[model samples]
Target: MIWALGIFAGAMVVPAVAAHASVEDSEVLAAYVQARAADASGALGQSARLHGAALALDPNNKILAARTLRQAIAAGDRPLAVQAARILDKAGELAPDGRMLVMAEALRRKQWKEAGLQIDGIEEDEVFSFLTPLLRGWLAFGARKGDPLAFLNQASTNALADAYAAEHRPLLLLARGKKEGVAELAKAASDDRAHSQRLRIAGAAILADEGDRKAALTLLEGDLPPIAIAREQLVAGKKLKGAIDTAQAGVAQLLVRLAVDLNAQNAGQLALSFARVATFLAPENSETWLVTSELLAAQDQHEAGLAAIANITADDPFASTAADTKLKLLIAAGRQEEALSQAEAAVAQPDADADDWARLGDLHVRMERPEDGAEAYGEAIARADSAVPGSTPKWALWLMRGSALIEADHWPEAKTALQTAYKLGPQEAQVLNYLGYSQLERRENMEEAERLIREASRLQPNDAAITDSLGWAYYLRGNLIDAIKTLEKAVQGQPADVTINEHLGDAYYSAGRRIDARYAWNAALVYADEEAAVRLRAKIEKGLKPELVSP
Candidate 1:
């Protein structure tokens, strides 16, 4: 079932229509089939158009109308979305989301009463009821009927809903020109969540507007690109603009937050619908465009994602994020060369920072140019070190450089980098596993490697790769029985991993299970890379040599 329908699973069941020989019925069926295929393939825009065509032929079909509404919202086709939404609304078959679409259109036109009616039409859906109070608050604020903050502050048992309400409470206060909002905003921005970061940015802008320069600067304390840009602007005595200046923008912020949460839950279509509505509410808001782009990319609509990202201007605080998303979309669309070119250009700028160099390194690594990746990572480490005098770069930077060096066969440097990473992040399981596995593979520091791998296994016992490393460690120690048992467990955890399968085969052969060893090797051959496939075939044919046996 589509994730959008998962929230109300089994609530609405469309009765199957009787087969008809009419040409109109045939055309509708063909279009519906084509729409389903397009949706499955992630061609959401095409799917929306096809669904619309099918619905046009069978205008009274509630199922077709609902499908068209969902597809239209996901594809950002506002006209079709409105048409389908109204159809369902008039028939009293509108889902919560359809009501939201109708409300969004009313909100767009400042038809507060119409929008309120649509909001009132929303039934108590488990997944959507949490938004009801917020919708009421924003609607009241827009219509000047009551205190918006009162509606937002109404107690709720839903923790997720409360968090969102808390986030919006300060913004609503600020929009009303209340000075008490500064303290509340400060409290909300203490968390590290993305929404909190946005609050921090908005709060800082509000402070700057109020001439509290010191407080504004203090709010923008992070090293993120957006914070850095905002800090620079504040330092230059420029007024930073607040995120939500109007009631429409407030609702847009709410929808964007909802969209992000839904997308994280793997409901891309539902998320896109909310994001599209947010774009209509706050068309110039860079954050809305960024969220829209990310959700579109999640659906494999890379070209459309790029188009959405292009809405962000270069001077926008989210420009860096937009650039990053554009790079991902380009790569996902098989335009690696363009992505590389953009990455290179970004790093070539005189003011390019560690992030730019790191992004270039990442792109190089993705393109299988590990040598270039190592070089770029080296530059990133250098710039990062310079960025904060006397402080070491982040452990992840060293780990990345180490991995790139290993891929490029620069083992000596890789070992040094990996050791540095381990020193900096001894508690990180990934760092422990990588460093230990590298030492094990090189036949160097065998006892130490085993110790590291053992600690990593303790840290993350369910991690298949680390478990496989522990098994391989036992095999190298000539503990054939334990090795076979551990390797078999590892195979069960990750049956398709070529290295783990090969290790199991090796352990089996050493345990005198010759037929079982051959079987394991044959299984490994099925999923092995070309190089590993040749080695596995040879192992299956002749088995392990006596001298090569661990025991």
Candidate 2:
């Protein structure tokens, strides 16, 4: 049976008859073309239905059949995905993605030989060339057939292949009881920084198995985000559990790696299917749960995303990151009060670290409790020491504290914190912009403020907020002409920004453009916060005072 997603508000509505009616081939093809265009624009559900409808009309169109298979997989319509796969298999026209769908289904059904055949039959073209060896190796390893590590090592010559091998090959060794592989695994991990997290997890597990529990604990007690399995367990002589314990779990881990890679490349919809397969195979794997939640959240399935994150056990080392993900998902879902409460509670926990404190501070600031935010940031800064085993004290923690203090109207403290951040990270554009903008707001150190802001704009020319800050700085210095020109450009880039619009209006009024000033103020009024809106309306009605309109 074909699946149809309900129409989105602005999405083009397909004819009701198109799906059920015995439509002409040309008409069906027309619908397919329109749907393909929409799909390219990210309307996956509508596109999948139209593709299904087109396949119904002309069942023998191989290209349409392949597209329907791919779209069905992307839409999470497993039944439709399977149905389309059958169609494509009959026509012998499966794309690489379609083949992956077939392979996932085969693995799900435990048809190991069939899955192996699917991997073997995948075309050795440019697109699949680099991926083929890893895919084949994983299948071989899962079936306990050949030396998969040899295949992985062969594929490691490629950068991406090396990263994948560095991530997963150690897991294979652990699974197969290959203690001898640890030395090689450690060297590979040290060579590739990109896969450090995976290597660390594998290395810790290997060390635990070697009876070096203390070393394993030391290996993991760093700033990097932890994987599942608690430090307490490692310290108590329990081995860290590998995600790939069984063949099915091994396949699932491979699928998860593929999904993560796809996600990094922004192929999120495609990544979703792989993640779904991974979760089904290894629900106990906390990383898979995190990836599944992230993919669902990316698709705006907030409730499902929350549930997925909630499935992670609290004792998992990755639980903190999962908690962080949950907070953001709640905020995105407009459950801000819940997010705030959760963040507050999380930071108050005994094990809470600098990142946790910083998260709480950010939440407080976002919820408009700037004073509370500054306190939380202060806690974060106090936690940043060698005892915690982080790489370095993050300048960002001080920067956030400083910005929150500025928001709370504590000028001297804000300046101190910001100066500390500047000394730590002089090249950071965000630090430069915020500190400079705050200086401009304070109406002090104009020369230094201008220099910092100029450098920030140079570093990030397209950042509308930075550009607006530069314009506001000009306006503050009584350079109405330059202010008008710069603010106009900033407004062009960020028209809906209440502050930018307000700045533009002030510039216009100072330059004797009363009509344009009123217009800009009205635009600002439309998007401004309540306080800003009140000020904007007053200017719109009573006009700017002489001081504001002065040269």
Candidate 3:
């Protein structure tokens, strides 16, 4: 649930103050300037002087008063805080937070009634509606003055968007031993669809408290939309086919609404709790399980989530989604063997779709099982090639296949895959650059490789590696003059790239500028890895002697 009012707590600006006769007051301005400098250095001593100076310059400025109060609160100077609060009070206006700080201190001494009085004293009751009522209810709850149930419930209802009020609702009732009342409230809430599904679903469990299985069944009998109805079943375990059916139209829409409301109202955590309950109730609801799985993933509890997905059935529409979730969980948990096995099982499924095949392929690639990955990619290509543009698998599969082939050390095959992907989406300069660089590294296709690399650099001129690759290709072709110039350009574009700097150093040496070459190599040595640094260091030590290069 999003707390709309909570947003009001931060950075509400005070209108800027107009300069007054005291603006140029030397002592005050000097204090103010000193304090500004102090603030930059994270000091509080200057805050006091600055407050005094600002107030002196403009006695009527609420901005000064508010800043003084806030700074005093941060400085741990109660006397200054009291002084600032007094100023706001004397002006017949108040900041919503002004008195809360003082009241908090008063409560430390068991001055409960005093704190309550302080809350009532805030001048702007209308602006502080939710806060004032909630605070009063808290004080009442602490003092055990009657049951705070009535007060807190009223406050929660009035402050619908207030998280504290909502969370406090069950607490107040629970302390009063109102299990029956809470259960009764759930029963009564059966008519409010906004909160109806929650009530009905919780009915069976909470009704167990009332020993009324009949009422639980009655509440569950409503022609509730698919999502709510499906979720009712989701509680059976974790995964469910019905979860997808429920999330289809009306019920799915409601879930999103409820989810967003819970998120916006700061009830996101509460929503998660409720979602868990909902999933528990309808354990067969795959959609609900999916939601829970995603939530668990976001919370970094992917392992337990895989267990939840284990409840899904083969006939479920969302079964593959559950499989994917399990695969991801296994991967995240470092259970690569399990993920690979699961991928193979999914690949063998008779109804496997293009997406399923793609996922299988990607899983293989992730595990460094390139041959298997390529076979899975092949299946996806055969399947998706006949689909419409939007239904066709994106170029990513081709890229993945290409990458797998590269890792398999099949340079020609990798080139073929990459070239196909490039032509499909030729504008991706990274792809173009990688293919070009790969060819250059192969050392057997210099001219065509140079053409591709130069084209990539032209498209993405600021890209450091593409520029470096073009320059490196030139050097490999024995065009030392052009290589030196282009590598120098590459160095200018990527001053921090150790490899580019190293290449520049080599270019300088090849151009017969030994001293300049040594300087560039010295710079490269400072940032290069141990191996590169060792090579450069040896080069420097040898002076006129040569150093061996390694692949």
Candidates 1 and 3 compared by lDDT, better number: 1
- Ranking by TM-score, best first? 1, 2, 3
Candidate 1 residue 110 Cα shift, in angstroms, is 2.1
Please say which candidate is ahead in TM-score: 1 or 3.
1
lDDT of 3 by residue, 207-287 (tens): 434454454444455433422333444444333222111111112222333444555566544344334433433455455
lDDT of each: 0.79, 0.73, 0.59
CA deviation > 4 Å runs, candidate 3: 1-332, 387-396, 478-505, 508-551
Error of 2 at 205 (Å): 2.7
**Candidate 2 local distance difference test against the native:** 0.73
Residue range 1-551, candidate 1, lDDT tens digits: 46334223322322231032124566766667767767766677898998898778777777788889988887788999899988888888887777777888898889999988777776354458777788888888889999887887762667877888887888777767776777788787786565666677887776677677877777788665577777877787776754675668888888999899888898887888899988888876778888898888777788778878898887666666777788888999999999999899988999887778878888889889998998998898888865522122467788999999999999999999999999988988888999998988888898999899999999999988899899999889888888888888888988988888888889888888888888888888888888777677767777786443321
Candidate 2: count the clashes: 0
Q: How close is candidate 2 to the true structure, as a TM-score?
A: 0.63
lDDT of 1 at 517: 89
Considering only N, C-alpha and C atoms within 3 Å, which residue pairs clash in candidate 1? none
At residue 359, what lDDT does model 2 achieve? 86
How close is every model to the real structure, measured as TM-score?
0.73, 0.63, 0.39
